[model samples]
Target: MSKSILFIELNPGMESTGAKALRICKNMGILTYVVTSDKSFYDSSLGNPLNDAEKVYEHRTDLYHIIDLVEYIKKLNTTHQFRAVTSLSELYVEQAAFISKALGIKNHNYEAIKLARSKYAWRDFLRNKGYAMPKFIFIKDINGLAYVPDEIGFPCVIKPVDGAASVAVSVCDNLNELNVAYEELINYPGFGRGITLNKLAIVEEYLEGDVYSAEYVVYKHESYCLGFTDRIISGYPYFAETGAGFPAKLLNEKKSKFYIESIINIMNFDNCILHIEFIEEKNGDIQIIDLNPRLCGALIAPMIYEATGIDPIKTLIEILIGDEPNLKRTKNRYCESRYVGAQCCGKLIEVKGFQQENLKVG
Candidate 1:
């Protein structure tokens, strides 16, 4: 009998990471049921980009939708008997954990998942572990705005505690600018809609340095530093990431070793895949920005495989499903996926060279 896997996601459909997962599962001889939140997920142009896969399911991106999917999956397990449940989407990580725990399957500890998902929680965890983190406070609201100095003064950053794709992250140089930034964030399209701003926001003393992300594979309580990559983020007041490239030509062996050791020790991570952000200041001090417990969505793993032949996604799944992840660096090929930024000009225009091979267009 073939083993089954349950996947939940909020993306339009199987983008690059999803496609990678699909390919790996097929090769491993495991049956996969790809679950999305809605039919619109498959309706968008990005929905069927791969156009190669034969089996995938689309549901709505909603709580009720996911709950129903879980129920259906549970029923199927009695008949099909799945081996594991996992997710690559940030929003569904905790949900996946809950499902796996309920099913008595292999998964990351729920506490580890929570810490990885929340920026504020992860910062506090690292700080408490004696890891160097920027001075920060979690604010419930603008109440007592005058007391900002008591925590951290001007030149601070305001970002949602649980946010990705660099959404609503702003750097404020002064008091008035901070207020304006907050307002802008509250008014962003997804705010108060997808997630509640009233929950909490983090105010932190901004550290100046070159930003980079360290990608690691933590299997059976051992952390393997596959590689680090330079994160390209737009400058303040808005810090949206544009892309990432692997083999982080910026870091030498010593610097890489220091970051890897620090992350492993501070996070106390066990048997998980992680993506962490760090700032290497001019004085050679390293400060952590945040970390995520899933595969970094910007195709960082594939880029690393392209550049250095180390695939983090494949390795992570193998760990989750009880298979040993291949930790070999196969080839030195630099892979990069650039998001073509477009404005609200109109409907559609001509896109050139997208059909070329070796390019994963989402």
Candidate 2:
């Protein structure tokens, strides 16, 4: 039997972390198989990342359904000896855990994955564990929206319990705004991949101050804090990330360490990368806001590598497949990943300016 890895659904479209990982696996002679819902997603011009994959399986069942995904993988398991099961997509991280468990592969802790993905559950878990977290209330039904002001208060954030890409994430200052945000959260659909949106939402007290994401690489029993990445958020009432800077500047050394250590010790993590998002208070205190038990994203890999001379994407793939990765920093510099948006969403007509001098496109 040949050794193989069963990759769960990958981040589609432009982000190429999934593509880069598959290429590395191919180069290292690790048989790779990607299971996705839509095969054409990886078949597009930008989807060449799948070219390096040994095979791509498009399952007929809904990718959002864990049991269905597990059953599909189990059938695939009989044909290929899978050494590991993983997902590069944050939305599918928890699902990958369940599939790995069903296949009896050593992976991240399932319960911990659940806690990390569910926003309300994670905040409560951290709070119970003595970590200072933002006040939050889970609204399973629209009727619960009325309690937002009394429970979490004004100047809060209303977001889906499990959401990404800042979809339906808004800062509400009053009951009127809160109601508007709530309706948007409810009307907003899921990933459109056949999975029904959870519809459950969370109204959380908006933590004040700057936000940063810290990546920790957990291999064996020790976790190496990769570095902190600062974020450039868009002008609000709404919270959508615009850009990120590596090695957060003006970081409160004591509070940052305190928060980072809290994350490492509090979560039930294993041999996987933990992408924890946190807010640094003006009073020099830190509060963890979001947690994703996986590598940050596609663009983050190159940014981190250029900034510190370490390839976290490769490191993530190696560790997930039960292999040791070289985690040596050979460069000391600053790298950033920027997200450019336009007035309207449409096809990429032309993107220029990379030809300019003094700009290292990573």
Candidate 3:
């Protein structure tokens, strides 16, 4: 039987885990079909791999938005019979889950993925389950922002319920600041990739502390840890993750792992790869600050492989195709990534790839 798979929102290159998985699939001889935005697929500045992959994958990708992808895939599957349908992009993961169900492919529950997509809904679910989370309230519209619940108080964070990459995330200490954040968040149109915005704002109590991620590769009935990544967070109230180091240099490793797993088991997420980010509070309480259903982004896959020798991207792909994944850690090393950002936001004219020969510690 021929192996085939559907990848949704596969960002062309950018060292993303999705891009890495696409390369792996092509190498494995899987007929790959992608549904992604034109902006990412054709951008050469990010080293567009699709230019070459289009020939190897046995299909030429046309510019298709997320809205038309589902129906189009359904029609195409009549002939292709895709074995797996998945995406690591926040904009399309939920849709991909639904497509998997629609195609009778084994994947996570669509509702679970949906819940994960909306920060407000996810937070509400956690609260109802008696999970320890910071105080929060959901604002349906600009009118709703005026009634900021007193229970949450000031010094809280406000962000789009369906946001990613800290697009409109902000911290507000008073009503004036709250209005500013709400305005900024609500004005942003959509979550990119042509997907509709959730249009809901979530105001959460500010979590003050050190940040780290509890990375896992759940195979079969057991969850495996690839080790935590110590996060270097900056951008003030924006909380942009500027850098990270694998095998987080911290004490009480066992306790933190146990605490994080307990929360994961409760969420009952069925994705093969689980990347949950948490904050070790100033007062010593560990709480899950963000839960991402995909691999840890920011080019974290290389770090995981360098430190643990476990290929998380391949592991996820295997699990999606109903195969057992390898979770063995073959190496004990340290790897870290530091991101460079422009001082002012502007349209990308181009991006220069790093030269390996000239690389040095800053």
Candidate 4:
């Protein structure tokens, strides 16, 4: 029987990763399929995986409705059997876990994925494991603002319990700022249609340290830290990420391998790729900030591959199909990525500098 893999959603911005995965599966003679509401699935002009996939399934239902998505996949499976399930997006990681479970395919722990997706839950899990973490509280609504503890006092961070791409994440130094940030978050417009938003937010003590991400892959209970990346975020009260460079300077010194390994072992993450964010204090303390149970989004994957010839996206596809990935590095180089956001609300007037052959616009 021919094998097939189901991608829950080809997350926007990471279309290159999804397309590459589909192409790899096709080259291996395995069928490729995608289920997404993204209009790009039908418009090749915007770069669609449909060009590489055997079929494209459309579902407008919210990803939070796991049962509906699972049932939808089950119906699709009656015609096309899927051996494994995966997603390139963090927003649908939980849904992909449930669908994989429903299809009896190998996947990350569903409960673990749920906890990893929530900053509050993951912090609690790490605390329970005796790991040092920032003091935090869960806020359901504005009224819960009173519960923000004194110890987690001024200069704390506030972010949605379930969020991605640093959306709706902010830092407040006082009660007034906290209140204003809370109000703004509740009305944040980025939450997509049909998807249920987590009204709850995590208010935690802010840590003073340099930020970095440890990227790793877990297969059959064994974890391997591919490397680390130095995350450069916008200055001050806002924690918007600007760009990242790899391999992280600390990784070059080889001091972080033990800590990264310990974190993965304690978390017991399996059959998945993970991107863990942490703070490195000047005093040599490392505290985890976020644990993402999916491939590192943005250009991190390609950046890693450019630095070290091991392709994480391809390895993830291999794991999905029950194959051991060759994580060996065949080359070494330095890579970095930056995001260019519009400085003002205006139309494009002129372009410059991108005409160079060595530069890529997007």
Candidate 5:
């Protein structure tokens, strides 16, 4: 019997996880249906990327844009059956949960996703559950900072309650910087004066440390450790991640252990995927930074596969489809990702060299 699966917002075919999913489904002969808002996502990027078995379903539904996706998924369910749904898009994780519940498919709960997406809510949840986290303030009003102590002060980071790719993230040195960051955050892309944006901005004491990310698979209420990666950042004041490399070569071994246990304890996972960020201080104390219930971008999945010979994405998908996945590590190798940085701010011309090297495409 052939299995059916739905993938949401599979874009820019060069995306590692997306490409892997497409390849896997195609190879397994799964009746794959790829969905995205833009029909061009199929034609322009995903076109002929996978084998003929995988089918593309284009709809004008921005899965992350809220209402449209929910309605569209409901509409799609009336006509087609989806056994599982997967995507690397962090923004659509909740919507996927909603759709899964609506269609009676295997997936995490909407409440779980809500807790996963919102930094302020997740922090409070962790603290309430007796888990350790950084000192944080959820800012509903920009003026609320005036009452807070300045020592919690400059060099702190402010970010939206629910955002991805470090978008609208800013590090404030003082009151003036914080104020400017606040204004810029409110006007950020993909956010508006609505329920989504009003959840609150998180102001946290900047935990100084080497940045790293953990990728894991949550199955049967237990989280399986995949591996860790070092985050590469670019820009200033609001340094967004350029890429990631695996395995994380942190100076301290205990710090990596702390990251894994702390993340598992906080996320309360049972059959899911988690991408967590952490900072390791000079004193070797590890602090959790941010958490997402999805895959990290910049080809970290493939990187992890190269490093540990463990594919977290496959395990995640297997769990999503109600299949027991093997979580054991097979082999280990060192892997790194080089960000394709532009020398000058100009239109992207073309890329080369992939055809010659054994480098994994996407």
Candidate 6:
């Protein structure tokens, strides 16, 4: 039987980490298969994720339905032996976990993934475990506004329970600002890609500190800290990320390593890559911001590779298939990614300092 790996969905973007994963698997002589709802996802122009895959199965509807997804995979398994199942998109993390469980493959705990994906649930878990985290409350509706404690008063952050990329994330400095933030996010379209927003939001005390993330991989219950990166965000109101640089200078290696291990022990995460964000106060106290059960999105993987010579996506694939990853550092250098958001949404007409040779537009 030929070895094969299944991807729940290939993320679409110019610098898609999912496409990188597919290429790595193909280079390793493993047959690649992708399950996506849109057949157009295979278009050659969009990084051609399908180019690396041997087969593409279209599950337009019920893609997240575990029973249906499992049935579809089983039917396909009769013809192709699927040795592992995984996903590169945050939207499909839970689905991948469930499918792996159904197939009896090694994977992160489904319950733990669920908790990690939900900000409220993750915060509650940390609080219960005596971890340092910002005070937060779950708001189910407008009526829940009364429950916001005075301590979590003005200058709090409001965001969806399950969200990414800083979409609809905002800060409220007063009651009126809080109301506006609530109204805007409550009606925000495309939350979870039309899956509905869960009608839940989290308002938490804004921790004042420098933001940084620790990227790591867990194999056989052991965690390896790949590296730490500094996160630069747009100041005030809108918390959109401006840039990120690998080998963060502000991170305390010993303290960060201890926190990452504590989180893994509490969540019992296994056989997955974790991107954990945290805040370091002026006094050096560390407080967790969020935990994701997947590779860091955008150009983070590439930046990390460029700086430390470790490919996180490739490491994840090897771990998924029960192989030890080569973690040797081949080089040491600085890598950073910066984005300049458009002031107005429109087509491009002219360009500036971003030369073709020095930078990638997307």
Please provide, for model 4 over 1-362, each residue's C-alpha lDDT reduced to its tens digit, 9 standing for 90 to 100.
89998887665432567767888888899998888765453455455556678888778646556677788899999888888887777778788887887787756577788778888888888789887777888899898888775658878899998888787788898889999999888887754534545678999888898899989989888888888899999988888889999988762335566776777777777888999888888866677788898898778888999999999998998888888998999988999899876868998789788877568876
Clashing pairs for predicted structure model 6, backbone only: none
TM-scores for all candidates: the values are 0.85, 0.93, 0.88, 0.92, 0.84, 0.93
> How many collisions per candidate?
7, 0, 0, 0, 2, 0
Which ranges of candidate 3 are over 4 A from the true structure?
12-14, 37-41, 52-68, 344-362
Q: Can you write out model 6's per-residue Cα lDDT over 41-120, one digit (the tens) per residue?
A: 54655556666788888773233456877888888877877888878887787777877777777664788988988989
Model 2 vs. true fold: TM? 0.93
Q: Which stretches in model 4 have alpha-carbon errors above 4 Å?
A: 13-15, 38-45, 60-64, 251-255, 356-358
Question: In candidate 4, how many Å is residue 80 off?
Answer: 2.0
lDDT of 5 at 273: 78
Of the two candidates 2 and 3, the one with more favorable lDDT, higher being better, is 2
* Candidate 5 residue-wise lDDT, 1-362, digit = tens: 56777876553554457767767766666677766655443444345443332566655444345566667667765665677766667766766676677666655556778787888888898789877777788888877777445536667888988777787788887888888888888876552212134436888887766788777777776666677788887756776677777887666766566656665665566677778888878876677788787876667877777677777667666776678987767777878777676668888667678778867544
Tens digits of per-residue lDDT for model 3 on 191-295?
Answer: 444555556888888877888888887665466888888999886667787899998854667777787776666767664687888888655568777777777
Better by lDDT, candidate 6 or 1: 6
Q: Candidate 3's error at 273, in angstroms?
A: 0.6
For model 3, give the 10-residue run with minimal summed lDDT: 54-63
What is the lDDT, from 0 to 100, of the residue 63 in candidate 6? 37
RMSD of each: 3.6, 2.1, 3.8, 2.3, 3.8, 2.2
Q: Candidate 2's error at 93, in angstroms?
A: 0.7
The positional error of residue 64 in candidate 4, measured at the CA in angstroms, is 4.4
lDDT of each: 0.70, 0.79, 0.74, 0.80, 0.70, 0.80
Q: Can you give the lDDT of residue 120 in candidate 6?
A: 94
Query: Alpha carbon lDDT of residue 342, candidate 2?
Result: 84
The runs of at least 3 residues in candidate 2 whose Cα sits more than 4 Å from the true structure, single-residue gaps closed, are 60-64, 345-352, 357-362
